[model samples]
Target: MPRKLKVFRTAAGFYDAYVAAPSRKAALAAWGAERDLFARGAAEEVTDPALMEEPLAQPGTVIKRSRGSAAEQFAALPADRPKPKRVAKARTAKVEPAPPPEPAPKPSRDALDAAQDAIDVAERDWRKEQRELAARQAALDRERRDATERHEQALADLDRARRRAQEDYDAGLAA
Candidate 1:
């Protein structure tokens, strides 16, 4: 007979695990050794089989029935009756005249010059901002490096002081 185990974990709530082993000790040993089974949870044997069985349907759950399956429901359809013959009618198509092409407006010389000046100014400003940003980033990076070095130096000094104190105490105790 298969043994059922209830495993619980922080992440995964609770689950039923089936073990093929005969004894609980054997099952625990086998499961504990196998990393794949209950990888994250704590496991214990469960006596009730109802914990493992899942309900076929829950309350308020809708089961969809296909209309095609009920052939008798559509047996009385009007498809058995012959459809009325459609009468053919003549349709007249009207011809439409093509619209005149619109003329394209020419740009003024001053407008063109102004647009070019705006683009040049924007480009210059972008480059200047980029250079300033790079300088600031470099300065920040230098400061961070200096701070890290100072921290390490302080740690080394503390270690040296501790060692000196320990050595002095040891020498006094030996005397």
Candidate 2:
């Protein structure tokens, strides 16, 4: 016979325990088993309240139950502290049919034409701006190149004049 397992869910995750086993011990073992599974690489954290009996599900897990002493105790406990939800194996149910599609709205031809015109005008303006920027950049580059060349030439001329003056002074001294 398949062992009746009491499935419990804790804040961390879910675990299964034999119903014949002690509730406290089984719950603790289940908790440890869940932690071990998590350590071994399980991603989902179980957050269901631990089950008190094998045949019965806990408050958060079950939809309805008689308010016995256990329920009373649960209620007596501060409202702030309540049982967590039970995580169970998902039930297999048939999916509902998809909703019908709605009709699509059509745009007017004038609106479409206006949008196209705006896009074309923007593209033309963007191209014109790009060309103007390129021309300005080229002109600045040429100016910088010419200025550097003139400065270099001026330095060379100064060096030549200094050398010639030094040679003339040496010749006069020799004479």
Candidate 3:
């Protein structure tokens, strides 16, 4: 008959892997190789024939009611002390009235033209940088592909050399 085993974790942060085998030595050996046991904490064997006769309880569905005392003692705790209040200060200096705001000067035609030219130059530079980046990426990809092809070719050449050497050695043995 197959044995039932349970693995559990201990309070010491170490896993206690349990496995039921024919012998204690066999159980230890099986436990060492059990990946789940090493990852978990502890285990117990619940293979009693009498326990198996009882029906299994449905998980999360069954609610067991607990007994409570008829007379319960109640106590009110003291509240924390309130913070001290701050004193208000009297103002002595007289406040001055604020002056009216001045209107902003409008931009000149030359300034507007210069601003548009600067924006155009910035966009042109950005496009140029994007193109340069694309070119660099393409070059890097090409180099990587070339290197991989070269490596594969070298491996094929080495295999051919080995086969030739083996053939020559067999021919010499025959002679």
Candidate 4:
């Protein structure tokens, strides 16, 4: 007979992951956790039915739920006192720039063009970085989906093997 399943929960970065499994070892395998989270006090058996519902429904699948909202987290932080405001001194006299009639050296177009080129280069770099991040995110999403598909396939294979073995045993006993 298979072992009875229990719901387990752990706090992962930005989310809490839960899984229903037969034991801590199984849970760890399902969670893909290399270290024993239970031993480190990072994970625990969840007995509460309300919390156990989703995990039980999808046994062995890691169900991640967002831990809390930004607002809630912000509220938890300690309040800092507002700093005193600084008042700027009022200017008694303002120095005006030389009149346009003097046409002071007519700001060089070369310097302006160089600054624009630098800005263009910076913008291009920013865009390339954004594209790389997007590609990475897509890859991560694909990997997650592949993992889930593999898990489902494994479960089906196990089920088929178990059924075939049981049938064979019965036939052998009957013969």
Give the best candidate by lDDT.
Answer: 4
What does candidate 3's lDDT look like per residue over 1-175, in tens digits? 6444332211212222223344433443544534443345333343555332221232112112222232321123355689899866558765678877888888679988999999999999999999999999999999999999999999999999999999999999999
Q: Per-residue lDDT of 1-175 in model 1, one digit per residue for the tens?
A: 5344332211122223344344444555544545433343454443545532321122112122333434654673657767899976546755568887878887679988999999999999999999999999999999999999999999999999999999999999999
Scanning candidate 3 in windows of ten residues, the lowest lDDT window is 58-67
List TM-score per model, in order.
0.37, 0.36, 0.34, 0.43
For model 1, the stretches where C-alpha displacement exceeds 4 angstroms are: 1-107
lDDT of 2 at 139: 100
Q: Candidate 2 on 87-124: residue-level lDDT in tens?
A: 77557976678988977877669988999999999999
Q: Which residue pairs show collisions in model 3?
A: 6-43, 7-42, 7-43, 8-41, 8-42, 8-43, 9-41, 9-42, 16-41
| Clash totals, every prediction | 0, 4, 9, 0
For model 3, give the RMSD to the true fold.
Answer: 31.4
Candidate with better TM-score, 1 vs 3: 1
Q: TM-score of predicted model 2?
A: 0.36
Model 2, backbone clash pairs (residues 3+ apart or across chains), number: 4
lDDT of each: 0.56, 0.57, 0.54, 0.93
Ranking by TM-score: 4, 1, 2, 3
State how far residue 14 of model 3 sits from its true place (Å): 99
Question: Where is model 3 more than 4 Å wrong at Cα?
Answer: 1-107, 170-175
List clashing residue pairs in candidate 4: none
- Top TM-score prediction, candidate number: 4
Decoy 1 TM-score against native:
0.37
On residues 1-175, what C-alpha lDDT tens digit does candidate 4 reach at each position?
9778899999887789999999999999998999999989999999999999999898889999888998887787789999999987669868688777854676679988999999999999999999999999999999999999999999999999999999999999999
